[model samples]
Every structure is written in C-alpha cells, then in structure tokens.
Target: MYYLSSDLFFPSVSEANWDGVLAIGGDLSLERLQLSYKSGIFPWFEEGEPIMWWSPNPRMVLFLDELIVSKSMRNILNRNIFTVTFNQNFRDVISNCQNIERDGQNGTWITNEMIEAYCKLHELGIAKSVEVWQDKVLVGGLYGIDLGHVFCGESMFSIVSNASKVAFIALVNQLKKEDYKLLDCQVYNPHLESLGCREIDRTDFMEMLKGK
Candidate 1:
C-alpha cells in the first residue's frame, strides 16, 4: 500500500502484502526499473491502472540443473527444426509478446509504454530476448531482465504450438552454458512447473539475487 515518488526508491520486499503488491504509482523510467529489478521488485499492472509493483513470496524460480525437458521437447530440439538467437531481434520479440493473445486475458500487460521502457533496458544490455525462428519466420520468443547471476523472465509468446517452449529451452541451455545461477519466473504456473520451476521463499530468492 506504499506510494512511490520520483526518488526511484522502493520499500523493502518484506513490506509486500499477502498478494505481493508492494506499491503503486511509479514511472517506468530506466532508473526506477533498474532499481526495482535489482531489488527483486517488478511492475505488473493492466492498462488504465497505475503501475503496480510486486515481490511475491514463494517466488517461482528455475535452477539450470533442475530443468525438465520432456521427451517431446527433446525430440523437437534434436530435430533441429528451429533456430534460436539472442538479442538479435528484441524489439520484434517483445512486440509479438505484446500482441499474442492469451487465454483468460482480455488485454496485454506489455503496454506501449512498457515496451519502450524495456527496449531502453535492452539497449543498455540489462535486458535480453530469446527468439525462435522456423524457416526464417519469427514464431516464438521471450524477454527479461538479466541481473548477472539471475535472469528475471518477464513474458513470452508463441504463434505456433510449443514455439515458446522451444525458445525457453534454448534460453535455459544458454544460461547453463554461461553459468547463470537461476531463472526468476516471478510467479507460479503449471506450464513452468512442468519445466521444473519451483517456488522458494522470497527471502531465499532475494539472497540468491545478491549472489549469496
């Protein structure tokens, strides 16, 4: 229930309520966004609503060693039917994520303002994207903040079945090779669980964010 100002500061994650909503009404400026992510806070508000920041307890995360690639996914990866690239077309990847329709959702959280803000972060190498290409067509991708040892995944979209999955798998493999510690999924979903993402106490997650 805290309110933010132009100071680019956030209350401690411990101050978050039961729903994880830590505060409301903040600009998505680069400084504010960077400070928020570094502190394990992120904005997720629907259009027409003031920006809402959250740092949910029981944070959902995926450790590289714990990734679960299903047989079908393995077959797909083995087939080599898709090409994955990083930071090659972040703007497109994020635009697709903004437009792709999702079940049980009427509109996108990736608003025009959000897109511009994240793109700024990407240009500064603090944000990144994973793109899935099939026959030279961009079919699926995802984007998130890269906090050195931890990657905070924001959103993903797929135009074809399993396309997003393909992108996600590629991302995990790349992070593993790069020796990243964890992938912060923010919240839980069945799809991510099937991919081996599990929830840990938010305090533990914050410690990991600090490279502890």
Candidate 2:
C-alpha cells in the first residue's frame, strides 16, 4: 500500500491494490477526510493500526430509488413505531457504533481518534446523522459524510431489533425527497445487500460521485 506524508496529498484511487488499500498512515484531519470522500475514498482501520484508505473496485452503494423495505419493515414504518431525527445526536450515534458488538467482529474499526475527527466534521456540517428513538429513548442511529448528491455511510448501531432498519428507511426516504443521488455503502455485506445495496464498478461510482 502507498504511504501518506504530512503534506496534503493522496495517490489516485486507481493505484489501490486488489484489496482496495490505496494508502496508509495518514492523519484524519478535516481537510483530508473531506478530500478523501470527494475522491471516492474512505479510511477504515482498527485501533492501533495506521489509518488505511480504500476505494474498492466493486464499491457497494444504494441508489435512493432502489432501497428495499420488506413487508414487516414497511408495516413497522407505517405504524411509526420509532421517531427519526437528523443531526440531533451525532456523537451519540457514532459512539454507539463504536461500542456496539457485531457478529464475527472482535472489535470495532471506529476508533477514538476517528470519533473525534468525525465529530469535528459534524461541527463543520460536512457530516450528518440520523437518530432513531422509541418511547423517547435513543435506540438506533447512523452517521455519514454528506456530499450533497452522495452520502458516504460511516457506521450505524441498533440496540432494539429492527431499529437500525427503521433509521435506514427514514434516511432513504428523506434523501429521496431531497433528490439525492445515492448512498455510498463503501463495501459489500449481507446486511447491506438485504437492504438493496449492490456493487458497481469503481469507475462508475466515480462518475456518479462527480454528478455525471
């Protein structure tokens, strides 16, 4: 993988390896993060590891019009079982994502450093959050980078069953209403696929990211 220097720069995403590691050892400063997402790249590394940047070949994304809501989920959404809000509790949402346990994962990639950095992005209005609450208690939420037409999803957490799904659907509907382009899921996973996220060529994603 390419190594980053202190100077504000990044190798082209096309230089990434087969595994999609474009570079390593960069600090997560606000400027770098902003440029990274805009270039269709993102940082993902566990604690103690140098910040690793990636731009996967088969990048996973969800077109707003393509979000899938099952009958059970649609019924729950129709019932309004949870209240969804935007940018209400960003730190809480990201913190929960860092702490929540997930199957097949021994630890979270969302490190303390990342939390502080993204929280700063939130302050600058480049990052946004969606919060899901039930009976006035926070149970599910998500956070991501907002590129106007594209949203780069960072992480999400759900304490109650299907709470995350509720938050996701709300985000999709809101983005649809705003005429957003797509949700960048970064990588492929079963959960994201179940929700209608699919892979596209990195070049195609870049074109879309450019609003082409």
lDDT of each: 0.94, 0.94
lDDT: worst 10-residue window of model 2 = 72-81
Clashes of each: 0, 0
Cα lDDT tens digits, model 2, 90-206, are: 999999999999999999999999999999999999999999999999999999999999999988899999999888888999899999999999999999999999999999999
Q: Write the per-residue lDDT of candidate 1 for residues 1-212, one digit (tens) a residue.
A: 89998787899999999999999997999999999999999999988899999999999999999999999989988999989999999999999998998898998988899999999999999999999999999999999999988999999999988999998988999999999999999999999999999999999999999999
- Candidate 1 Cα outliers beyond 4 Å, as residue runs: none
Residue 20 error, candidate 2, Å: 0.7
Q: What is residue 118's positional error in candidate 2, in angstroms?
A: 0.5
Task: State candidate 2's TM-score.
Answer: 0.98
TM-score list, all predictions:
0.99, 0.98
